[model samples]
Target: MKHLSLSAQRFPRRATSAVAAAAVAFAFAGCANYSGISSDKQIAAPDKFEATQSVPGQGGQWPSLDWAKQFGDPQLPQLIDEALADNPSIAQAQARIAKASSYIDTSRSALYPKVNGSYSWTRELYSANALFPPPYGGTWYSENNALVSASWDLDLWGKNRARLNQAVSQEKAAEADMQQARVTLAASLARTYNQLALLYALRDVAQREIANRQDVGRITNGRVAAGLDTNVERRTAEGNVATSQTSLTELDGQIESVRYQLAALLGKGPDRGLQIAKPVIDPKVNVTLPDNIPADLISRRPDIIAARWQVEAATQNIKEAKAEFFPDINLTAAFGFDAFGWSKFLQSSSRQIQFGPAIHLPIFDAGALRAQLKGRYADFEGDVANYNQTLVSALNDVATNISAIRSLDKQMSDANRALTAATSAYQLAVIRYKAGLSPQLQVLNADDNRLANEQTVTNLRLKRTDLQIALIKSLGGGFDATSTNLAIDGSGQQQAANPTTNQTSPSQ
Candidate 1:
């Protein structure tokens, strides 16, 4: 390798400057027009959510990273862990992260120089009819060449840097997506487990009702034999017992169905569901909100975080698109040896060296550059809108769940009172009939009312548990964005972590 220097005497400095000025003028004049196009979408204000007002569990405990454990269900946490570890969705999200990382590497590479080397040899016979010297006419000759080349895009307009930033943002989004998948899977599994718990509770109630109905049937039969009640009463009592039995059977089937759903959520076969023991959940789980209701939600929810990153990526894309309208300047250099014969290739006389600046700009591409810039702006606006929508929906999700949970708390209290009253009335009716003071019809009616109240209370409790899980999910399933590389500002803007200081600064 040899270094070649340029002499001002050979290439006058005055002429060089003239050429550079002309190049710059031409570059500017031919640059594509991209003015007056930009995104106008703004992030939704976090405080707009009205339901974030002070509620029952406001300022209480926020869901921990292991939110499933808070439910006091031993099997649920294990099931959620298995689902997160073994689910195909998790694997798919991991693959996306790997792919996004690769893109980052690819984009980052453009910021550096590239070098290549090549060697070639060929043998050919010259035609006699061609213009050639008599000695070489119609003769076979060998051609050999070896070359090394290097090029570096100066990126004076920051195009490549913008692209790199875009890739980084996409990678961050992928990471957030994976976390979102984990949150979704864990929450879904826990909710399904809660359903299984509710089914078991209902089944218990059904069994008790069946026994109660059978006692009524025996009482009716005794009354009919004594002519204290008509045959119609005895037949109706049999029908009541049959109805309760049918309900118990249906409850069993439903329990099996819910088990199957749990099996699927666990990413396992149906047989695995059969192995699951009954879920024992603490019924006193209460709804709680973190300190920063909607503000912290921006960073907590993975969907919102992912959407924000997408907006960041789109912003970078606009920068990149704008850069394309300017001159693309690069430094190119080559050192090589070329000769007609192999013997001369290694000689100093065969050496060749070249270096220069290469500049290119869009002269006329039929408005392609402008169109690309316009498309980039559109993409940015769309991403911004998407981010805003996601944030709004996330806040509302939390609000809705909290409201329902609070409402369910009130309903549960009323339901318990109704159940207690119905129980007392059913007992009184049974005692009166046994004492021959009331008809069998009255006892049957009271038993039906008691069963209905019992079912309502059981269903409401189940709903409360399900809502608690939903609320946890809505609160981001214990995700902590500050723990990750990305950070969120109070205004809900995304900030990048500074590699040197390991601190977050607002993204430009």
Candidate 2:
């Protein structure tokens, strides 16, 4: 009995000593091989844009809120509003954003633990004298086993984190792209709406021409009946009326074609309620536009920001890809109970456990790893180039639009003056003809000149409006003086993230 008591005490001490030694070993193992990521919070974006030319610009301020309200046409506002809401391209951009966000979530999943469960059952018959023969009686009994295992790749190399960062950057890029698409769509819809308005105004002019020709035809027929006009003269007047009416009919078809395009922009069928009302031409609209936009407004552009974010994502990808050259460390372990009998499975003596770390260093695989690194490096270079290009394009767009707006302003003034002169001439010819002082052909020619001049002026107005839109687009689409207050100071403001360019991320 004493021997048994002593044995029990000795066993407990031995077990305790073993446990203490194992814990120390584990602590030493865990403290090994530590590394840190560099926390340099500065993003090195490409240099900013600088225009090469000193171009002249209209000096007056352009109205903010991108005011189409100057047209005083309620229909213009309604069409723009409805198109923004129902445009399929806008919806597509939204979907891209959502899809990219989800992909980012997927990329981030690597930061967490990974667990797997597996089970198996195997049986085999062995001939006599085989290794251990058949375990029990007969050929073989059922062999059943199950394992619940888990593994986690420690991000000591920052590979997973870098990948996560890349995804985040891409996601931000996608957001910018989506916004850019929205502005582009809005700009397109506005431009088409204005085009339709021009067609309506031009149609009205054609109708006036038709009315004047009809009046001349009636006068010539009356004169012919009174023996004061030759048959050839009356026929000539009727022929002019027919020619004007034909031109009017042709223009009417062209006008409907523009309306159909507007309907499609609104995502409706040809016969849908694209009930576009005519927009009135406002003769009092101020054509003077601002030319000297501030240089620091580039960041507000969705495309520019999107390109910047693309650079960020590419930068993170290069980091992640470069990390692949280093050794990847993985940890795997399991803790469970195993026993020959089910009753003993819970016993401490029946406990089973294992743990280990694995490292994979690139030795050689026919230069595949090096090729990957090179490829990623090339990709980084490409991203840098793309960013520079985007910046340059943005700069050129603003400069060109500013120059155009100024030139159009001058031309529009000249056109209006010409139109006024033509109107005076047309009125004078009408007075002389009524007093029997001028031939009908002279009156007809003067009125034709006036009508043509008016059409030219109306076209110039529409052209100016279009130029306004272009200037607005060049100014980064609705971004204005207020954006100067929200300066991007290059302090990793957006580039430091792991983003997914799912904002349709320049999807190349």
Candidate 3:
């Protein structure tokens, strides 16, 4: 068997040379070729904001990745783990990453060659009806034939590679996007669980009120039976008991609803509740903000980093597009088996192969290719805007959290003081009423005030915890912005764990 003879032919060689020269010139032109999105020049971050990879700040403690573990509550860590493992949004983001990665390979693959194989058989004869037969129409002869051929598109202008490059850029953006999704999911789960914990604490306060009011009812009934209390006094006691009990029922419903929400976030059914313990009542949260760019925040936020990567990817896309204005080169080569007849398919006489190259020339497409390049350039311009927006969003998150932390700290303290005062005032009022010195209204007012203050304290604590999670997420869940085109760490542990998890699943 003879080996396949492959030869490449370049057409319009002069025209191809001119296109190559144009590509180089166009690449330089694309350097500033603003297309769309309100052409803003590419510029570095403003001097005020510090880059993430800066040096350590005053105390020398960089942002901690163990941020979640800092919550002394043992249940928090477990909930976060489950959310990360099961959250459906995270799974969908992971799927996108996989899809983009495969597309990248598909585009890049064009840089190489493709191979194909085939088999066929044919026989012909003419019986007194052939115009070019040996006898010009008598009973003619018959013959069998078999042959094989192959062709390849020669990449004359690097067009195929340009498309491949475009795909590579897109894939890179997708990877960063996937990481951003993980951070958002984790933050969501942490915040939802915090809400549930606060509900549990509030329920405790409601139950206490119910018990105290029920005792008042029992004592008033005794006085009424002994003929020492009027019907009005007994009725008032009954009303107090009813109000407290009503409050307790509503609080219980709230707790159950929150628990169900938590279960859903963990990708589980309502019937199968989560095992997260009630949050330990902590008056204050210790969140340390990084002082300078080098400290951690600049680097840690995922959305900001992902946005920046998008800009870079867009820039590459522009480059790839500009490369398209010129001719493209492609190489297709194949080797396999072809047989006209199965009996002789593999035989020495029957074995055959042939190959050659073909080139593509873009004479004119009415500026279609140029417009495509311009579109990519325009998209890059938009990416720059998105990058700036992300940077601003990150800054806003930090600023908002700082204010929330301080406000909650003050609110929680005030609530505790109010609760203490209300309790003491209510006790004194009860004694005065029994000794016939003060009206019972005073006691009822104080009791309601104390419960309200207590519930307020729980809610404030939960809000502070949630704000902390928000701040952490805004920083991108501890991702490094400077690392790009570098090997992504993790098994794509960021990869979707369950294909169906995103199907109505909510994992972190």
For TM-score, the strongest prediction is 1
Estimate, for each residue in 322-410, the C-alpha lDDT of model 1 and write its tens digit.
77777877777888998988889989998877666667867777878778878876777788778878987887787788788878889
Tens-digit lDDT track of model 2 for 275-326: 7767664635554445543344446577877776776777677567556655
Report how far residue 303 has shifted in candidate 2, in Å. 0.8
Worst 10 residues of 1 by lDDT: 498-507
When superposed on Cα atoms, how far off is each prediction in RMSD? 5.0, 9.0, 9.6
The Cα error of candidate 2 at residue 115, in Å, is 2.7
Error of 2 at 102 (Å): 2.7
On a 0 to 100 scale, what is the lDDT of residue 458 in model 1? 94
C-alpha TM-scores of all predictions: 0.91, 0.79, 0.76
List residue ranges in candidate 1 displaced over 4 A. 1-18, 48-57, 488-508
In terms of TM-score, which candidate is stronger, 2 or 3? 2
What's the true lDDT of residue 313 in model 3?
59
The ten-residue window of minimal lDDT in model 2 covers: 1-10
Ranking by TM-score: 1, 2, 3
Instruction: Give candidate 2 misplaced runs (Cα > 4 Å).
Output: 1-71, 121-129, 135-137, 281-294, 337-350, 479-489, 493-508
Please identify model 3 stretches exceeding 4 Å from their true place.
1-40, 43-66, 126-131, 135-158, 218-229, 274-277, 281-283, 293-298, 330-357, 481-508
